[model samples]
Target: MSGIYIHIPFCKQACHYCDFHFSTSTKKKSQLVEMLCEELELRKDEIGRNIQTIYFGGGTPSLLNSEELDHIFKTIFEYFKVSETAEITLEANPDDLTEEVIKMLNASPINRLSIGVQSFFGKDLKLMNRAHNSEEALRSLQLAKHYFDNISIDLIYGIPGQSNEQWKRNLQQALELDIPHISSYALTVEPKTALEKFIEKGKVKPVEDEQYREQFDILVETLTSKGFEHYEFSNYGKPGYHSQNNMAYWLGKPYLGIGPSAHSFDGRSRKWNISNNSLYINSIQAGKLPQQTEELSTTDSYNEYVMTRLRTKFGVNLEEIQEKFGEKYKLHFLKEADRFLQDGLMDTSEETFHITPNGKFLSDGIAADLFYIDK
Candidate 1:
């Protein structure tokens, strides 16, 4: 099934480690919203099918006002065939999720909430420059739980000063809140971000790979022991609470990504809109799609499929690979995966291959090693 992703690229302030495309100044938000609507109209025919999931990801989607949200929804419903039971999700920040906002969101079409609660500790929040304080984080989550049943929260571990005790406390806090789904990730210091600069200037300590690995194990053990499924590497969900939009994307289902810097994937190719807001607005206003398209070669598609599937419980199927990509790719995959399997980093049962316990933290690197660079 196909889905749609709407990116709202405005934030209250820049987080230290975030390198996502967003503007802190929201003066142009209203204009950008109009452009997004126009772009939706422009791209409706791309899907040509009923949308099963709709995701409002961001700089911060919770920042959208009721009127702004309504306008976008109206535009979507007008042009697109959305399923009656579509899973609609919004990514929100704790600082922005006051009771009134939560009530409004519950009243709207959004049925899922992914709150940005990077850490439950003030020290970690401050170090990451999160917009919310610790108290606000807890308060917002409790409030959201009252309004929504399908709730997810984003948490980051392995901050510069975060101890194992602190990380455990954060997970404990999430459990106490009774959140159904969680999207937890290790803090990566992206180039040109404030965190990288801080490390270079000696204002922040460099992130430790060992620390990340330790915390990752703790995350897996704690959540899975509590009956949460490690569905994807960075995601944990109780039964029936997994993110539909995420599943759609990972399963190679087509999706039309709306708004600036967003991406779209058809069965054959992928494309992305321009990252600059002004340029995107101008281009959409002029009735042009400000995006670049790349037609995927068979090798590109196969590599992507292998990369995404290996990290999940749904392992790569050798039979499907052979059937879809021919004997050459299946043979190449098996040959490359042999070393990892022998190293005890990968496991195969019947025709499917999955990440072993020792290989979970290194899934991405292992996937990279298996990627065939077409010469």
Candidate 2:
């Protein structure tokens, strides 16, 4: 089955560390919603399979009023063949999930709520320039659990001055809430973000590698002990609560991504829409897609496969690689993986290559070393 992702490129405010394509202004909110529906209709024939998942991700999907959300959902049901039990998710910010908003969302088709509760502490909130406070974060989850059973919350670790004890407390809070799914990530300093600027100006200390590694280890150990499956490098889920949309992405299933800065991938090619909201709306109004496409070369496909699969619990399937790509790619992969395997960074079982706990934090570097670079 396929999936659909709709990016709502608007937010109430900008977080210092965020570099995603989003606008702080809501002036184009209505126009953008309409254009999104139009884009969905325009690309209705792209996915040949029934839609099994629909994800509303972005700057903050919760910023949309109930009517706007309804309009998008109505358009989706009208244009696409959605499965009877499709998993629908919406990413929300804590401050936007008020009682009224929660009530409205309960009436909508969204079955899952992925709350952006990065941290449960006031110091961390202010440091990131988050729109919500610690109180709002706690209250939002308390209110949300009353209505939505399938919920996930984000947590950030390795803030410049955040200690391991603070990180443990964040984990404890999530466990106390009994959230079914948790997506935690390290605080990365992307280029051009305000965080990078602060670091450059020496106003904020940079994240230390040792601190980041320590927190990551704590996250894996704590969650796994609590029966949360470390299914992905940055995601933990309890039993059946794994993110279907994200799983579809990892499995390389085709999906249609609507809205500015969104991406779509078929088996052989990948496409991304322009990152500008106004340009996207204008182009859609003119009956043209404001996007670019690239055909994946054999080496490009192999490298991508290695990158995505290595970060997952399933690791890399050698048989699938040989059958899908060629014997040459498979042999090249085995030769590259030998060093990591000997270094206690990876292991093989039933002909599958998976990362060991000792190598989890360094998965990205390991995957890169195994990349199929062309001569």
In terms of lDDT, the best-performing candidate is: 2
Query: After superposing candidate 1, which stretches have Cα over 4 Å from the reference?
Result: none
In model 2, which runs have C-alpha deviations exceeding 4 angstroms? none
CA lDDT scores, all candidates in order: 0.94, 0.95
Reference-based TM-score, model 1 = 0.99
**TM agreement with the true structure for every prediction:** 0.99, 0.99
At residue 90, what lDDT does model 2 achieve? 95
Models, CA RMSD each: 0.8, 0.7
Q: What is the lDDT of candidate 2?
A: 0.95
Please give, for residues 1-375, the per-residue lDDT of candidate 2 as tens digits.
Answer: 899999999998899999999999999999999999999989998876489999999989999998899899999999888898999999999999999999899999999999999999999999999999999999999999999999999999999889999999999999999999999999999999999999999999998899999999999999999999999999999999999999889888999999999999988899999999999999999999999999999889899889999899988999999988999999999999999999999999988999999999999999999998898
lDDT of 1 by residue, 25-124 (tens): 9999999999999999989899776899999998999999999999999999998888998999999999999999999999999999999999999999
Can you list the residue pairs that collide in candidate 1?
none
